[model samples]
Target: MMITQVRRPATQLARLASLPSAASRPTLNTPWRRFASGKSKSNVSSHWFRNSFGFALAGTATYLGYTYMNGDWEAWIERQKEVKKEVIDVNDLRADFIQEKRSLKSPGVYTWGSNAHKVVAPESKDSDVKIPRRFKYFNGQVLRDFKIDEKSGAAITENGDLVQWGKGYSETEYKPTKTLIGKNLTSLALSESRIVALSSNGTIYSLPISKHDQGNGPKLRESSWMPFWGRQSTLSYRVLRPSLKLGESVTLIRGGLEHVVLLTSSGRVFTAAASTEHYPSLGQLGVPGLSFITRPSGPVDTCHEVTSLKGSKITQIASGDYHSLALSNDGRLFAWGDNSFGQLGVEFLPEHPFNDTPSALPLKKLYRLSIYSPKVTSIAAGGANTFFTVDSKRILGPEEDTTKVRDLGRITADTWSCGRGVWGTLGAGKWIHLQDSPIKVKDLSGLGEYDEKTKQMLPIRLRTMSVGTTHVAALLNNKTNLSAKNTDALDKSSDWGYEAFWWGGNENFQLGTGKRANLARPAYIKAPSESSKTPEPEARLQIMPRHKGKVGKRNVSMEQRVECGRHVSAIYSAV
Candidate 1:
């Protein structure tokens, strides 16, 4: 339509220009003046022909040029419209991003751009249905990690299989029907196969796996799994320092990015190399001087049993990408190694290069940094961060007996996420690069609240969360149990009440049981709840404003395979 209109103007202008002016030219019928002008009939014909031909030629050229120019104009107009549409699309997308970001700030779950999914807990029923333990158990590779259910003594692998450990107990619903051909497992760690399991009576076993054999079938060696360090590379003149001594057996194993640390129940700490000469990866090993040693050079350096620390027993230890955390029974936490991101949670210490050499400076000369002095109950370490949950404010003396004391419940300061880089893993979208102090994830306000009148601006309680290489998986306690009709916890019915919700990272199936889409925040996982008997919709990310209604309906069932780092382990309390 616009093209036709544009061509009409050029055609009209060419037509007007081609017309002769009657005042400028003599009329052809005025032949009396033609004799005096010496005009002939042939000349008259030639003149008429020239005028007609010239007019035709001029009009054709003008029309052709105008057509070409009109075509360009039309093209420009269309290009402008396209550009405007693109601008609008970009603006809408940005606005959606901002809205989703704001939604994440609410206490309930929300999606960013990843494949986050929501999970609801089942509603309470007056009558109890007995689900056989055997039905819950299956035989599979304990890929990431395995944990024993405290109540049932059933071992669950990373692949979601539950295996019964004891004799006669294997007949329960939680037990795998078939016998597992390999190791009688205890516990498993992700990325590395440094399995920590105990024999029936109480003998601790550690199985060390070489990197080359990560995919091999489960093979258990009945000795303490200790990794010894050989001499440093001769090609480099730099002398590597040794951290943990392997002469002593490892009682506890925690895997980090590239490095692994072993802590004896007796309170001694040992570590081993994470990298090889072939390739060097970051977070692969502790600082150069912090490498693992086969033998201690001296008594002070020897990895002997620690009986000191004011008689406080060492209960737990956590290793981060570069740092290590130790928690004693006394509730005091000891940290060493990298301080760059403040994973140590120690404040006042001047920031230094995150290496063993820099952190090895004299204590008196180095600034002492303090982060939190909470009476720690447990600690967890991630790629470049560490988290510690504490028990109470008033730390009890090691000699004090509290078995009879009423549990006042633990006081956790608030959840915080800290790390390096710009991958948007930390829930706090604004923070980037290394952080020396822990920062609470943004948009996590109002967790565990039941009513708008009682909504908390800050989370009072957070439980059971895991951090991946780039995302986080957390199971939050709603603080109340009720029917499925309650939508306060992510508009989720009671069916999803106590289950789990995943947020962050959609590129990989990190969010679990959802369409592979990256999310900006947390969302409910609805697919797992759909029974195989019912027709289910196709899987998709829940980040969009409206859920796709038809996709899943056509496909009765869809199964998604997720590869968790070796295994996904969590601490659960069966109430």
Candidate 2:
């Protein structure tokens, strides 16, 4: 050992080099890492701190990169700020209106029963009873136009002012209250939780419905109202022009549970989901099987014109819970969207049994159905059913008047129904559960009385019809005499008054028959007044003097209009 130590200079130099120097190496006992054996705690801590700092810097860089790449960093920062709160003053939203003296002879609005929200007039002193009540607030005001949904109602006065009422979070308007006073409203549409109004100037206004305080359960609530006139407003309404490219004007608008269908003056049809969440389900927008590579960010804020209905002059549109129906000027019908209960009026196939799986059927586009011989005059859609009013006579040339043609002493208008009939909503007959194609409603031939002298039944022509979630209300022309020779006399004495018939679900007395039982066949609904004849037509005085006029005795009401809702019904009449 002594001899080797004297000669091992290379080994000695290697050992000296292996030992760490104080300048370059850390001490054994350091605060960061004290429990160490042979390892220098400071060195270990410095290495660990360097590696950890590098990892932390890398993690921070990665997060920043991710947020920047996704474009959410700014939004996240904005969300962290304290937002200024604002309150809407109802008085500011209202106009300075003075009630003018109204005539006793003006038309009245009558609503039957209640739904999730009560339909009582806001001016009504009685709060307990909520069934078949006349709105006294509308007594003096002439209701030029009106629309209703499950929980709300809107009307346009003859003066062009808009009136609205019903249960919403903002206010529970039991009575008709004036709104958007200076702006003349031409039309309005109501959905489950929203109201859309079209002004005479071609502007659109929307208001969010609050659901917390006034319903069976809580639902989505919008905090403010907006007017879509020229520019989009986050709190107020937005203009639906350049964004939607709806041209300069909109002619008609129809709203469903969560969507809206618009008809432009140029005969274009466009649809929009009420909210952004529904954009993925754009089939409701009438663009079937539409797929987007990137998720939309409130694209429904604007609307897309339905290309499938191109070149067709769409005149009318009707919407249900999850489906839509469009009628063209050429008497063609197009249906699309949900067909879970055969509401689309398309033939049922085994592969496409229900609309539960939208991908399988991809019923995003509208389809024209091969309806029967008679041309369709009007269409109405319910929650799960569709109703069509067809001209009973064949297509007439331009020189002919179909109204002049009488069939077997009856001027009949056929009503065809398709879709879900679980509650007899189709009104075809008892035990008919569902119909995929339009079928003429049965037992409608006897809508009028039988003429004993002619040994034939008098005709009852469908004047106008409305379909509810589970019921139907039809205004029928009850012609008493069918053999009159004078066309003028026939026109004068044809009893232009309309009788209302109701069928289908009556669980809430929506049939207005003072009963709550479902009706398989159509049943007569009594008029609000017991008078044998309706008030004399005001137009009659202009033609014939009051004393010398040959006024026809009409059992039905005059200027009659019927509208139905989820579990409620309404009638407008001039007493």
Candidate 3:
């Protein structure tokens, strides 16, 4: 009778109240209800349980809603399961191209700073060397022709063999090794990342190099591929036919950053681009304006002949980072592409309709420059500037040794530069910065001696000059010393007496002045000696003892070939 009087549990009361009606309550036969009813009841409050249950339900709803809305739930799960790429140490992959221990047997070449490996001794670690050591591999071989770019270099041997060496992938060690063994490359030209070799038969071959993705061989693509997710990806390199017509023979090959200009034996010019889709504005291919067309497609992969110069005979072709220059047989220079720096030498009118459309059509034609007296003989295009070597004899007065000028036919040329002069590259003295038209480099006169009485430096004549991104190198006229009173001194001499002058930016010691300072005026570079102390066994063994002394002392005054790269300069010494 006492047990029957006990009241119903509070949980039961609460459960009954939560239901819509008594009929909605769970049946006693339900498994969950039966299990709950059998468990020992606690004295916990119903309000606290209700609050806890509400929070748990709200959190679960929020998580499910967010995942459903984002649409990346599967991607998130995939990322979580991805395995990370293994980190590699590049040093372990490095292998020496030269022997670890070697001796310097000859002083055939010298280099400085970052790209010293191109010519410096492989076993040597010095950044600069006054006396260049000879490469053991090319000990007895003479370097016939050589060209270098920012990071790589190619040299042609007298035997028509080409050798290449530079900083390989990951800045790993790479020795100077022979390449294109049987190709018989007579000459080679180097660009930022490409090498164009001119075979003895006037056939041109190009090899493009990539600093990344060594596993994949060089592959050609219709369009440049973008990096994955905006991250830098490995670049692929390969050798391919340079967009030429079938059986086309290339007499001259010039390379730009992403394009190549080819000159045929018939004096016709053609240009080919590496990736037109990526750099459509470069106008490197010299293709006509196709603005009326709607997204034209198909084989933009071929080289296009420059139709503008149809009747003109192009004698020389040169390319900059983004522009192309062609010098006609009549000494007429034509430039096009990327005129932002006025590199094209074209003036824009204020009222000219501007479309901002980069195309090869409607080309800018420049007829005259500031130095109008002398005609331009040679043209050179740098990163953002243009250079021309003018006939100094035409500009010189009647009394300025006309006899010497006639003797050295087109040999005494003065360099005129235009466009960007940020690092005093124009060599027009310190006051002038940029020159829209070609301006004479007043300070680049020939070698001279300081006159104490007049308190002025007498200038010598310049034989040849070369221009880099922001530097200039001039070869002084050794045939005639302008400072000497007698005109007979201008007589051609076997004694190599000309001096090499370098100026402008020397940050990389490209000026070869053994300093990192920029020179507003030209500075002299000393010639490498071939004394017994500076032994060149190859030259010694090849020559008779009487001619041994004359081997390395050949005519340095004849024509000192100067070549300039990004921040480096080189002189071609046949000896």
**Runs in model 1 lying further than 4 Å from the true structure:** 1-183, 191-252, 263-312, 338-342, 345-352, 355-377, 390-413, 442-460, 478-499, 513-523, 529-575
lDDT of 2 at 37: 47
Ranking by TM-score: 2, 3, 1
Better of 1 and 2 by lDDT: 2
What are the TM-scores, per candidate, against the unseen true structure? Answer: 0.44, 0.60, 0.58
lDDT of each: 0.39, 0.59, 0.54
Candidate 1, residue 180: CA error in Å?
9.6
In the range 1-575, model 1's lDDT, one tens digit per residue, is: 77567666766776678677978666876777887788788988898899788767776676567656656656666888987655534333332233222222221211112111100111212121111011122211222233221121233343333233311222222223322313333343322223333332223333322222223434433233456533322111111122433553345666554445556545655444333221112222333433334223542212222223325456776666556666777666656656665555544255454434212112221113222134445566665665554332333444555775342232334445544424455555553556555555534433434445545332344455565555555545444333333223222321222334455444544455335554545555542222447423333222212111112122111111121221121222110
The local lDDT score (0 to 100) that residue 24 gets in candidate 2 is 64
Q: What lDDT tens digits, residue by residue, belong to model 3 across residues 195-297?
A: 6677877766555543343335444442334544343223333443444556667788777776778898778887765432244355555655632142245
lDDT assessment of candidate 2: 0.59
Each prediction's total of clashing residue pairs, residues at least 3 apart in sequence or on different chains, is 49, 12, 2
Off by over 4 Å in 2: 1-104, 121-131, 169-175, 211-235, 242-248, 275-282, 291-299, 348-372, 392-412, 445-460, 477-496, 529-558, 573-575
Q: Order of all candidates by lDDT, from best down to worst?
A: 2, 3, 1
Candidate 1: minimum summed lDDT over ten consecutive residues — where?
Answer: 113-122
Model 1's lDDT to the true fold? Answer: 0.39
